[model samples]
Target chain A: MSLIQEVSSFLTHEADLLDQGNFEAWLELYEDDALYWVPSSPEQTDMKGQVSIMLEDVPLLKLRVRRLSHPRAYAVTPKPATIHLIGNINASEEDSLVMVSSKLIMTQVRDNVATSLSGAVTHHLKRSEGGFGIKLKRVDLIEAGGTFSAISVPL
Target chain B: MLTIDEINNIAGVDGMQARAYTDPDIFELEMDQIFRRAWIFIGHDSQVPNSGDFIRTRMGVDEILLVRQPDSSLRVLSNNCTHRGTRLCAVAQGNTKSFVCPYHAWGFALDGVLKAVPDIESYPGSFDIKDKALHLISAARVESYRGFIFASKATAGPNLYDFLGRMTEAIDNLLDRSPDGEIVMEGGHFSVRYHGNWKLHHENANDTVHPGYVHESSVTSARQAEGGVTPQDELVDRGQTKGMMASNGLTAKDWNAIELNGLPQGHSFMGGFYKSGLLAPQQSDAAIETYREALEASHGKEKAAKILGMDRFNNLVWPNLNVNAQFHQIRVVYPVAVNETIIKGYCFRLKGAPDEIFYRAVRFLGTLVSPASMIFSDDLEIFGRVQAGLETGSLDRLDSRRGIKTDQKNGNALQSTTSSELPLRTQSKAWRHWMSPDT
Candidate 1:
């Protein structure tokens, strides 16, 4: 497969894991040092002073996954059904790292309310063993600054 | 319009009537009597330090601009242009020369004076820019207490300090934590909306019994995570997330030990912060020690300890503000309609403290106030469920008598165990005071 095809496949696989609610498998696709960031502002530069929607390392990620799968986690009791559409895919590979940028529009429906969230998604993949592992995943939602109801699932 | 007896029936000491949360007429009256008459928190002085710097905020449901005047003072002016009544500013916050109406090009100075307008020949001779009526409306009173600003529309009422009652300690403790005695609103703010009455947020904030039942999933999840970082008895944040989640697992008996104080002005807070997570009164880290020394340098060691040792959570000012001093955060509740409310959360950065301290404040806010918070999502759900149930008109008065009998009067305020519901009863008392025919 060409480099673009390989990158696209990896991205699709990762998106599929989250969409299918297979959080355990999704957690495996990330490197131990990987960071997941959903910034509160696209213009945000410093994490130390500025707050973000979600900033988690491996331990925090595992904790979040655990919370998501909790039997009584009422946020997802009647789990939100989601479909993630990815387009405008672009990638560049250098040495041991590949950077991919894409646009994400996720539609979620639960309890008769349907909502769509769009964002600019960026992923840093490390070329390891055979395929790739996620070094970082950042999603900048267009409506990050706007008010929202409870967001139970990852964007 | 509700009768005097009807208003009395809506809110009381034992409980509150369901229509208090569902009646549009009462909501309108609340905007006039409560929000307008009370000293509502506007923002911090740190937000607008320079001339022309301004932040768009709310005073009740009225859109207002909290602007730093050219003379280095501050003014709270209605955001609507006098000509067409269109909103003067659309941006959330920024520095500006003057507010020019987008529709008719009428301009108002930072102090809300009408300075410029286009095509003066098109209007009659009666049009006068110098007339005060042509300028933007200003709040009747604006006052600052230790750098925290509040505005009131009532021409005659208690001053800001008198209205604050015991809640001033919450703001004082937040600023005194810094060695330089200064803090700024630096962290990006989070805004979340819940389909519920505005009062539900505060009623739930200081209520101690809801944590165990409302946030059971997060506590259980944090408990399952295997590590030395246990939230059960830990005083520090280890991975912080688990600590925050597990802290909610505090037994009912443990919660009962914490104290709750309800003041006469409808203000209240739950004490015993040392019992919890990152807010744990004890900081053992090297960075915290450095922060301690800096604070000690500014304030004597005894004063510093007194400052740090004072620990409480959710110091709620009546009507619509939650000041969490130990956590260096504040959540403002804005009423949109009878059933819809918007909550905005902001954190403060202490000037001389270590960056880690501010980062912890940001993290604490995210974990608890984010739209996707594991803990808050459930609360939002419960708030919605409450509004939904109340809409059915099933019950007349919801129970708030849990600790009524046990409440002890402590110098103009009522005190009870955290396991009680004294805050709601106190809130109802203030509600009746403002909503009565005499007021």
Candidate 2:
């Protein structure tokens, strides 16, 4: 497959895992050192000094996934239905690794409220034995500085 | 419009009227009486330390600009332009030479004086730029207590310190924590909105009984984290995140052991660092050690220990602000409407403290206050459910009579059981006090 096709397919598979509530499988797609970042400010780049909306490593992500499945996690008790639509894919590959950028419009519907979040997503995919492992997944939300309710589900 | 008697009757001894949280008219009255009359926290002096520096904030329901005057004094002015009631400055925060209205070229000085205007021939013969009416509306009183700024529209009630009362210690403790005895609001903030009454946030904050129940999922998830060999870097990550989530899992005995103090003026706080837990106030990491030595150098060892030993969970200043002094964070609540509220969480950077300690503060803030936080999301969920339930009007009033009979007077404030609903009652009583007619 072409670089664009391969990257697009990879993102699709990843989104399918999240969209279908297959969190356990989704965890395997990330490298141990992978970073899942959602900056709180539009111009924010550093997480150490400035707060981020979501800055989770693998361990935190696992904890989050576990909470989502917990019976008492009332925020996700109804189970939000989400469609993570990726478009405008731009991919460049070299040395068995791919650098990909895309636009993500993820819409989550739960308890009759449909909330849509759009962001520019950057992915660093490391070449691995079985497939590519996500080294970094940074999503800069368009409304990074806007007010929000509890975003119980992962984006 | 609710008469003062009707409004006072809303928040009574045993319970509060459901309309207190659901009615738009009552919300407006609250903006007028409680918010406008009381000392409402605006911005920190650290935010705008120099002249021309300013931050946009809200007083009651109206937008206001908290600016530093050319002489370095702070000024709180209504953000609306006097000409057409349009917003004078749309920027969230910035240093400015002057505020020029975007609609018309009417410029105002940093002190809110009408400086200049455009279209000389467009106005009526009575137009006078020098008139005070043409300038931005200013708050009747603006004062700062230890860099924490508060504004009062009424300008006749208690001064900032008097209004802060025992709550001043919460601010003092935060300031004293700094090795250099200074702190600045450095990190960006999280602005979170919930479709719930603003009171629910603070009411839930110091309520020891709700953490174990409202955040059971996160607690259980933390306890059930994979127990196999963890990676080296993930250890610190697991420790802090796990500690924060599990801290809410305190047993009933432990929760009861935690002392809750409700002061006059609706202020309350929780103390008693758990005797055993990851969040134990005594726990010292390398970062903490470094921070301690720095603090010791600035303040002698005894003073440093006293400062560090001041363990507090939530120091709630009535009606709006929640100061977590030990954690170096504060959450400010803004009432958007009857059923809506916005909360902004900010962490302070202690001057002369090791970067590691500040990083932990930043991390602690994210773990606890972020909208995506494991513990906080549940709280927000509960708040939404509360609002939804209250809007149904299934009940006329909400109960708050827990541990009231057990309360004993300590100084001028009422002291009650640690896990009781004393904070709620204290808040409601103050609500009644501020909502009543000024005789």
Candidate 3:
């Protein structure tokens, strides 16, 4: 497969692992220095100075993963089953920076109430030796500032 | 004259009358009599430390624009446009020269004086913008106490400090915990909407007895993750031994031995956590020191230790604010409906504490109250269940029969114990007063 196709396949496979409740597989997709950030602001240009809804180092991320899968976790009793559809993947390059954008629809259900959250996600992926590591993943929800229920896991 | 019978019949202590939460008529009455007449917290003066910085906030249902003036003073103005009554500012916060209305292009200064209107010769040339009629409607009274700002819409009533009563000491305690003698609002706010009433969450703060029960599963899970020890038992031993010392664990009897301190103005706290068998030694030490120094500075050493030992309870500040100074956080409740409520979690900087101290507080929020928090998830379930049950329109009353007649009254505040109904009963007193015809 071509480089673009390989990257696309990797992204799709990762989403599937999340859907299948294979959290360990999902964690393997990121580099050791990787950061998972969900910016609170739609126009947030930088995470270094601003706060994100989810800002995790590797250790914090692992703890969150454990909490989600823990049997005693009451929040996930009616687990939020989700299906992420990624489309319109656009890849570009500027000064060796590879940027990708995709239209995403993440349908999640909790307590039998389904919510389809559609957004444009931009991923700044840096090519590593064997795979691509995310420098940044920005999800611009059509509605980011309104009141929301809990969002515990990766979108 | 409203008899206690009428108050009880109109609304039970535990569950409220449907009209109190659902009916727009009652809301209007509350807006006119309670919100407008009472001194309500706007924003801390520290929020906008520099001139021209501003944040848009609300009181009850009224929209307001809180701005820092050129002289570094703060002003609260109605966010509505003076012209066609359009909302002057739509964004959450930002700094600007002067707000210009998009509709008719009317301009207003930051202090809210009418600066200009585009058409000079449209109406009478004698139209003077300097008149107070052209300015944004200012709050009836604006005042500050220890950098915390408040405003009331009605012209008549007590000044800010007088309204705060003994709660002023509570705010002082928060500030005193800070090394620099003052605290500022820090960290981003997490706004949450609950399926239940706002008062339920406010009342939950003073509930010392419910934490171990409602949060048992989360506590158990958290304890399990930490290996063969529990956090609560560790917390208690730390207080007696001082500094990271882990000793014998607490029994259910230990929880029963915890004391509850109920303060004036419907505020109360449960005090036995210091001796509880939960917190690690150092965690308990630092927390106790922060409380002790603040209390001692205001009152001597013995009085301070007494106050510090008395510290750990939830504070329900009159109408809407539920504060937990131990956690350096406050939860502000906005009632959306008789059945729905919106809660905003705000964390504070304890002035002079280390970054780690603040981080521990944030971790406490992370472990216990955040949306992803295990404890809050269980809380939300109970709130949701309460909402579901209340929708049945049944005549079932909320039970507050734990320690009713035995509670001591100190002015308007009620004092009770772990097994007491004082905190819940105190809240109902404030609720009744506000819901009355002549509060």
For B1-439, candidate 2 gives per-residue lDDT tens digits of: 5677786679878889898999998899899988888999998989999999999989778899999998888889999999899987888999998998899888899999998888767888898887888888788899999999999888588888998998999999999999988999988888888889988988999898988888999999989887443453332343677788988888888888777788889999888855555583778777888889999999999999999888778999998999999889999999999999999999999999998777778888888888899888888888999999999999899998888787778998987656789899889988888888862
Better of 2 and 3 by DockQ: 2
Q: What value does the lDDT take at residue B115 in candidate 3?
A: 84
Q: In angstroms, how far off is B132's CA in candidate 2?
A: 2.4
Runs of candidate 2 exceeding 4 Å displacement? B120-125, B227-238
Two-way TM-score contest, 1 vs 2, winner: 2
The window of 10 residues in a row where model 2 chain B has the poorest summed lDDT is: B229-238
Instruction: In angstroms, give how far residue B56 of model 3 lies from its true place.
Output: 0.2
Question: For residue B358, what is the lDDT in candidate 2?
Answer: 77
The 10-residue segment of model 3 chain B with minimum total lDDT is: B236-245
- lDDT tens digits, residue span A1-155, model 3: 66567668767987798888788778776655556655555786643323345555444445456666766455566678899888888777666557778878888887787776667887777777867776656677765656666664477
Query: Candidate 3, which segments miss by more than 4 Å at Cα?
Result: A21-36, A39-52, A56-74, A88-104, A116-146, B1-8, B13-15, B71-73, B120-134, B226-258, B284-310, B337-339, B350-352, B361-370, B410-412, B419-421
Better of 1 and 3 by DockQ: 1
Going through the candidates in order, what is chain B's TM-score? 0.95, 0.96, 0.81
Compared with the true structure, what per-residue lDDT tens digits does model 1 show for residues B1-439?
5677887778865799998999898899999888888888899898999999999988889999999998888899999999889998999899999999999999999999999989988889999889999888988899999888899888988999999988888889999998999999978899999999999999999899988888988998888876643331122233777878888888888889889999999989989845644335664787789999999999989999999988788899998889988879999999989999999999999999998888889888988898988899999989988998999999888989897788999998999874889999889998998888677
Q: What does candidate 3's lDDT look like per residue over B325-348, in tens digits?
A: 666677777666656777777667
How high is the lDDT of residue A119 in model 3? 75
Query: Candidates' lDDT values, in order?
Result: 0.87, 0.87, 0.65
Off by over 4 Å in 1: B228-238, B276-279
Output the number of the DockQ-best candidate: 2
